[model samples]
Target: MRRHELPRTHAAGRTYLVTGSTSGIGYFIAEQLARTGAHVILTARTAGKAELAQRAIRHSWPQAQLSTLSLDLADLSSVRAAAGHLATFADRLDGVVLNAGVLAQQTRRETVDGHELVYGTNHLGHFAFAAQIYPLLQNTLDSRIVTMSSYAARWATLDLTDLESSRAPYRGFATYKRSKLAQTIFAFELDRRLRRGQSSVSSLLAHPGGALDALSPKRPPMPVATTAQVLRARPLSLIAQGKDKAAWSAVRAVLDPQAHGGQLWGPRFLRSKGEPRQERPTAAMTDRVVAEQLWQLSEDATGVKWPSLSQPRRL
Candidate 1:
């Protein structure tokens, strides 16, 4: 059945969980989903941010079904707790947007789990959370896990020996890019596993092309770039887009019927910023060897794995 198109039944609406919805592209993803009358769950590092995001969504989409959960992806305990709370909070889950992530830190940082902050929060944390909630997602009739990735993934190269970049020189931007690449690899690997298991759950990826805060719309409660900044960004609009518009790709992956597992959704213009459409990922993005390796490393690092998916087969 098409849950997205289904009438708002008395039982409840299609439930979608969007992480890091307190601001940036994550907020927009949650907001857009709420606008469709879906019961959107917003997650932030703290209860305050979550509440803020929920309020902002409610203010604009008053009728929009909304809830909030505190999730600190930098901490595995928090991810587990949030997933536990999430499983109990909702009876059904239609989709999950893994949109929460730290980007472009000026200095290299480590997560509470002792891994690189960028990789830990963006990839490993989500991986563990997804595993924690795998059963809930499986119970849902048809569910999808849409990963919010980046164009930086294409430029990334993984050093499995030093996934944390401790041994290697670490540029904050380079670490961030590698983290996105790791997560992107995980997304494809997950889809393959789901397909192999014949599960109803699907995994997909979306990248918001060159999203800039300066180009985004002012949503009131949330902060926005200054008028001067916006004006200065006008010339760059040819290639970049506002964060609000950038969110459409992830939103489409979460709810669009045509969005299938393993497919990438991105911008139409310059493949970065425009209407959401099917995007062609580069060869590196779909490399199964690296994906398989990353999956093993992720399972080992997170100490979480899907029990039913232990066939020991590679595609």
Candidate 2:
């Protein structure tokens, strides 16, 4: 189908909360959604970025319904506060794009919540946020939860026994891969739970293949000074694709009628720069038993539980 032939989202009165909307692919997706008339809540760690992004969006779509919210996914308290704030502002949420995340940091650090920086920010935080906001989604007509994963997740091993990586030394890129794998596993697990309970909310996952966008702009610690050395070693612009393609994949997942629950979408070509295709999560990431275990672990770690579960375990 042609570019214009694809279904454009019509979200006149709907409300959407897109995490990490201040930059990169998240910003693109949130902007597109706001342009379509959705009351979009763009989240950032600081008020300045959020306000800056909101203003940029308004500059383009003058009448756009855009707002900003402070959310630090690495901190569970912040996640809870954001969820509560969203609940207070809107009775229901039509869609949520879990696009905010960090990349391979050179050093080993922990969030205020004490989770390994990569796994904490990439997976656990989002897990808590999603679980806390489960009710808001449940109240919507056809709510959707969209998570951003990565191709590196395929290389990961789900080491649930030591989820915090305290048992092993910090290996930057590998840890990132593990967290992404957790995301895929989390999405599958969430879908299974939703299916078992027959809930209307659906979970979907997507990946933005090697993009040149500054995915990790912050500096790494001295030990891992060459943290993003790989990017510098190669011509990133040549090897990496554009952010627009990733936005298309997200838009389709959020708006396409044919998009089914639990589906994973990515670029259609070898370089991840063409049309989007429906891809299944890797076997390691889709194991139902592992997913359930991860879900239980996440609940224990975050202290948030979905009420729709048949057995609501105390966190």
RMSD of 2: 5.7
Q: In each prediction, how many residue pairs overlap at the backbone (N, C-alpha, C within less than 3 A)? A: 0, 0
Error of 2 at 305 (Å): 1.7
Q: How high is each candidate's TM-score? A: 0.92, 0.88
Best-matching candidate per lDDT: 1
Candidate 1 lDDT at 56 equals 78
